[model samples]
Target chain A: MSERRTPDVLPGYEPLGAAVRTDDERWPTASPDGRRRLDGLRCHPSAPVWTHECGDLLTPEDHAALDAWTDGLATDPPAGDDGPPPAVLERLDRLLAVVPFYRRLGVDRWEQLPTISRADLARAVADFVPVDADLSRVVQGTSSGSTGSALVIPWHPLDIARDLPLLEHLLSRCGITWPRDPSRLGLLNVVHQEQAFTYASTMTWRDEQLMSRVNLHPSAWTDLDHRAAFLSEVNPQVVSGSALTLMDYVDLGLPVTPLAFVSGAVDLSPAARSYVESRSGTTVLDLYGLRETGPVAAAYGSREGHHLLPRTIHVEVVDDAGRSLADGSAGEIVVTSLENPYLPLLRYRTGDRGALTGAGRDRRIVGLEGRAAVRFVTGDGRTVQSVELTQRLQQHGVRAWAVRQRADGSVLARCLGGNHPALREAFDRLLQQPVEVEPVSGPVALGPGKPRRFASELGQ
Target chain B: MSDPLTDPLDHSVEGPDLQAMIGRLLAIPPDFLAGDVEAGPLVNDAVRLAGVRPAGDEAVRARGLGELALPERLALQVGAWMVAGPPLAPLLRTAPGEGRSYDGESVASALLSFAGLADAVPVARWTGEDPERHEEVVRALCRVLGLRPRGETHGVAEDRWVAVGSAARRAALRAAAEEQRKAEELARRLAEKRAQEAAAQYTHV
Candidate 1:
């Protein structure tokens, strides 16, 4: 390939180099010899190919309302006051009317009924799959199995259709304006194996978007060389992955920086999010959702609440009795998959808890109050979020910790890696109840693979 | 069988042949591309646009690229590769089944980045002058530029692709050290801030 190297290529460029620095910078590539023939190498930035063309799926008013909702703006004359508007409820009704599982239940209606749990779904899993669709074409996916059991849900293309535009809307929050010409879009997942899939398996998905998905597990590549080569080659404008995977790169000190970073699955703490954002020089948008549900909520920025995708699904924050809680009160999160007829889930309990803010199309989950076990009941029966308890301990430099609410309502705890030499007085005063604190020697017993900030005698 | 005339990757001969090659590469006759019949022109554009202006120690110095010592030029070159390489390489390296193309603005940005890196690499070397520090610099440069300096491609050729693997084994170690340094400082600050907030909240409670 180097047989006939252009001799004096250096000398020739010297004048051009001088012109670049000292005067009217003549970009040498402007010359005919340097003319770039980039037709195949580059795409013309035309209309987006990634679009589902589903914007019209919404009634014009609903479409405009959705646009406004995603843009973080209020629609004119607001879609609804306290309850959802007619269009929103109709969408949910239409989606549920076709649910294979609902029809099989031999029930006239499922909404406002006892919420479905993972155990219930697993027991009747077959009923959820749409009766009309061919089994071959449907895509089956498994959940994270974090809450004791995993739900394997089968989805048709229509199930995933709302996701593309909804994601397009969420990603926009990170200041990532897409339809980027000459850009490679890359996704990373850390599956704890060496390499589950080869690097850069699929290429560009559109004329404007070149896509690559890579597993960033230690076993995936031979070494850093392979990791660097593959990732830098697929240099993405926006790098989206789990919080753990993003932290792995940050801790490894990999130098590649993307225009934006998006993380989902696990909760990203402010401290960890700060480290990654500072290290990568980009903002991290925490997209909160479940495997059964696609893109249910997202925090546009680190400190913001998880905003609900009101157009795609209807969300209800219900108390223990299945009664809907008003805005500002935390309760179990129940969601209905508004678009999936193949395997529809209505008022499914997510095991997570948060409060809703705003009304109708403007609704958002201000913040997740952690899982049910994270609740700390005060002596006067006041429920305090475990994150608040940890935040107090954290201020005192408590690095690693696990706080458990005993059956008697007292608190037993493990604290490690901080300046909490005396914890009982500090904690008891905080909880307004007697507290037992023991500094854990090794890693704290936070429970399961992923730890809960707070544990309880009662389960979620 | 492709004719040598249409082999757009060829840079073997110069003068009118080079001009003809460039013309062939740049000129994709509209009718010829009626039904994706411009594979030659397509490959030509990719090769031409992605081609770097490789330089050597002297040429690099002239352009104020290699004028700075060892790792500085290497560092500059690496930053450029991060820019140019990501956009161009993925299209060629990982062409999807659907064969999606990238837009020109992204292509131009990528090419310019490669150009920056290409110009910087002429004198991108370690002179064994300060073996300990020079070794560290070389390895850091390799990681920075996303180049795995191998035994096969490591030299200071004028206007040619070069990847000097001066002490490649220790490159990862050096990069790791730098990375740890950045993380350690931030981790410390985050922990302290968390502790403060926790303490205050507890007191209020």
Candidate 2:
């Protein structure tokens, strides 16, 4: 465990490889202050947990100390600092100078780099991965995209380790203490609880917070009762999941109450949020971030827009042409991720559309719409996002669905799982008109990118 | 899961060479079929270009080139059932998509910002979620149709996909049993605690 010797290959830890490219050695190598922080790894005072495999992440004790140490160097700028911090800009400039992808793209300046789409990254992700990466440390995955179109961004091991603090800061902003109360569990409901995606561990990396990540995708549980029982049993003080997932769980009619529920991963519709909040009696905190960039923003309490996570990443709203847009103007959300030296993406085009309100720490993305929004129009001209409607159906346990407004202006709903009459009645009621529900063997019209939730051929 | 017995798309396309029949009927040119063979165009990209539409009869028409075999019809059914799999797997000739491994978390975070839930599903980059029931459903359809889809297609017909189906079922049974055992253990512990508390109260009295 000596500093001179390379760290052991921890369960999830990846050792840095020898320098390949001239600047490769520059990666994972840190400044004197940064190197001092790495000393926390040697101290193993955290309690032993049966399932925890990695002992490398900074402990909460280390977090408090390091946070205090880095406050002057790395704290957020004043509330009125309109642009990215000078330090962020300078580091990004240095990152651009080194990352192979940016270098190959000839991105001498941040603005010189072209904004990338999810489709663009999906196409060139392999090329974007750094050549000098320590292969063992690299882990890859696709985005949690309903359209099934998202980036497969690779991350350096250090970037993964660095995420620990960002998560803590984001959770703190949400008003919930992290390494949460030992008595109340921190339940994480993710997309898959399948065996392969099973993450059974205490928060050994931080404080040994009793945390569990369950797959909310239904298959993870034996039945709905099982899901409810699992939640009631865990009775997490902090329940974090996509807004839709939280809604579905709440709709299960469980008596479980948590201190707060953090919502992200999907559009948090007012209806869904209210449904959960009214029933569960907990605040819904919307965390705005992307995997390519770690958590960059989170709303405090029931705040309308998310406060920017400028500490971990810098966010800007720009028009389609990549021209930076003024505050309050809706445009594409562009992020300059401060993490991930393995495959640094500067000016990465997040396909979501939103507007930044306020400045510096107060900045928040408003009107943020991910995926091209298509609305299902009722005969009476009332329109709602089909994605929203589909989520509503999912709340009723219908998966794999699509709603289309035919050329003749007839609303048709198709699904593979449940053709529940109540679900149909709900859809019809939403449209304020009678609609046909067709039980099908396969999905309805699924166009590229996001699932074409609402398709209209009536020349809308 | 599309039932082999009920689908009107069920046709005469069959035999051990189910992949070939599907390839021929759909008039799937090599470029379109390139992804299925794990060759040609990048899988995710090629998969988007050609595939059966979800529209009922139109999808059937696109899937079945005029006349069809039971095996071919089953393949289409299998393809339809694979809406939950990689987008390209539905179009590629029963082969899995190769470029990326994104489970629910990665896509979920991007689809919506669940940064807390990010890396909740690991991105093994170049890996696709291979749920056993999907393979089991494929195997079940194949068995009922009595036409063996090609083995090396990589998309749907992996060499051990059928085995995966059985293994998944076994794992499911084991999981259910394990779940029951855990519940019993918990109940026993609770009961023991209750008894201990009662004895303690009696002793205090």
Candidate 3:
């Protein structure tokens, strides 16, 4: 198939190359309405020069399956017992038959099977993929998790599109409706990072509602003022980002107010949530999930905890020994999800701490402690968020690290497995302080269990 | 180190001939099979007979040999014994007790089957790469020879053999898991590269 040409409406369109166009041809099934929505986003004066090309790439069959799956989600039965439900067990059996990793273990019972950790995925992801899964449609996204190294997650387009309905369900529960409005952007995914994959796409599932992922970092825009101008003009109905990014949005002081703001990736304190809600005149919902596991639960308006979102996921709190902890006991958050066909995770350990309250459809994750947004004070008394440190550490290819700042503002970072001399220099430059780098042999040296990646004693 | 007595092991058809051959092969006195031997001497003998140097005291202490179950400890000893020795094919053909005769190639196969590792590992790997399952192999060897180590009752011997066999099966599964991990790591790298290339074209939120 010939590559789809960029429409002339996007005068700032700058293609990365023709290579991107080979498999990323415009969605053949895109409705005319969807095409117009895409053009509107591209033609907006506030839009950055298009750096790359992409679309929903959802086929007619994928659309049908996604719709059925989304529609059934509301009525789907809640998880059963401490063990996996019958359906999940059946899927596990199928996985054992085809997935090499699970087959090699020869574990038939759920209790006997070992829990999978992020390290396992980072080391050998293909082992978990079923042999029969179609690789033709696989797309990848990198997730720089709060605790570990960046992981490249393989995603099916249908799985990516599934987030639309999941979001809609969350919104509807909060009494918010996202009607098709061409004048306003459907959704805006904001990220405050040194660099990010920024692009524009129409949500084909949501009647081609316009959506885009924009980096809030100043480097992403031609003028620093464009950040506010773009947000003001699009006035996105739903804004999604990490709690840190949402705080940046509030700091931006843009005139645009969305119906709701979705905060993820980091823990959102009540004060911070209230701050964003009051500043933007919008409700802030805390979404708890990892890149490996899609949206698991969301804390909506006045909700005591994060209400479970997907019916296909079974959440459990497991102790260090991987035994299931009773409800109300805080432990590592483990999930068994059938969300992605390409990667069916069984008893996947998320490394986040939370307690499961209630049972069945009423299950909620309480006292959820994800990656805390830690701010490090530099030598000059300047404050820096852990996200920036994460970016720097990831750039150095250092995995499994812990960065701690003493009360005197001295930074000490212990990294596992590799000797990184330049990492200290990188840290020194990032924090504007002389940082000490210690190379350790294993994860244990970083500390017990999952280490807290960032900590500051400066009382920031 | 071929002795005339060991040479005719392949032709031996009687249980007594096989018993004599086993004594010569293991370099133990014929009556020693019926006597109790201390574990230290047995371990040293096995290490010496296998033509491999015994591990240092520190290494042995680190492995906690004294803390391990008798079968597990024996497995380690037997593993070191067989790791470097000549093929057991000739002696195995003359093994008694079950009224079974194994061909040269099938001796290792038979041992592997007895240990529940027939499908999980090849004879070459069991002999080489895997020292962890060596005791299980020795237990299977004893079952074929119908020789219970001296000082142990039949019931005790039988129970230890069962325990070692179970350990071997678990080790075999772990070996398979390791193999899959390596293969999957390679596959994951390739898949990751392809995904990166595809993602370079276009990515989602």
Model 1 chain A, poorest ten-residue lDDT window?
A: A47-56
Cα lDDT tens digits for candidate 1, B1-205? 3221111222221111222222232232333222212222232344334443322334333344322322222333332332233332443243322333334333333323332221222222222233333433333323222232233122221012223233332343343344344334423432341211110000000
Please state the error at residue B97 of candidate 2 in Å: 49
The sequence of per-residue lDDT tens digits that candidate 3 reaches over residues A1-460 is 4232222211112344322543325464667767876777777787765555566777889789988988787877776646676677767778765665555444556775667777667756776777667666777755777545667767777877787777777888889987878788888888765445577877766777788878786657777787789888898998888776788788888876898888887888887898898888888878887768777888997858988875577788998878899989999999888878778888888888989898776679999886688888766665667877776676667777888898878888988743378677767666777688888777778776556478888876
Q: At residue A453, give the lDDT of candidate 1.
A: 55
User: How many steric overlaps are in each model, in order?
Assistant: 15, 35, 1
DockQ of each: 0.01, 0.01, 0.08
lDDT of 1 at A381: 59
Q: For candidate 2, what is the DockQ?
A: 0.01
Best by TM-score: 3
True contacts kept of each: 0.00, 0.00, 0.07
Q: After best superposition, candidate 2 residue A456: deviation in angstroms?
A: 11
TM-score of 1: 0.44
Summing lDDT over every window of 10 consecutive residues in candidate 2 chain B, give the lowest-scoring window.
B196-205
Off by over 4 Å in 3: A1-19, A22-26, A146-148, A377-384, A407-409, A458-460, B1-194, B197-205
Candidate of highest lDDT: 3
Rank order (by TM-score, best first)? 3, 2, 1
Q: Estimate each model's TM-score.
A: 0.44, 0.48, 0.72
Predicted complex 3: CAPRI docking category: incorrect
Candidate 1 or 2, higher DockQ?
2
Cα error of candidate 1 at position A142, Å: 0.8
Which segments of model 1 are wrong by more than 4 Å? A1-81, A84-88, A91-101, A104-112, A134-136, A186-205, A369-460, B1-205
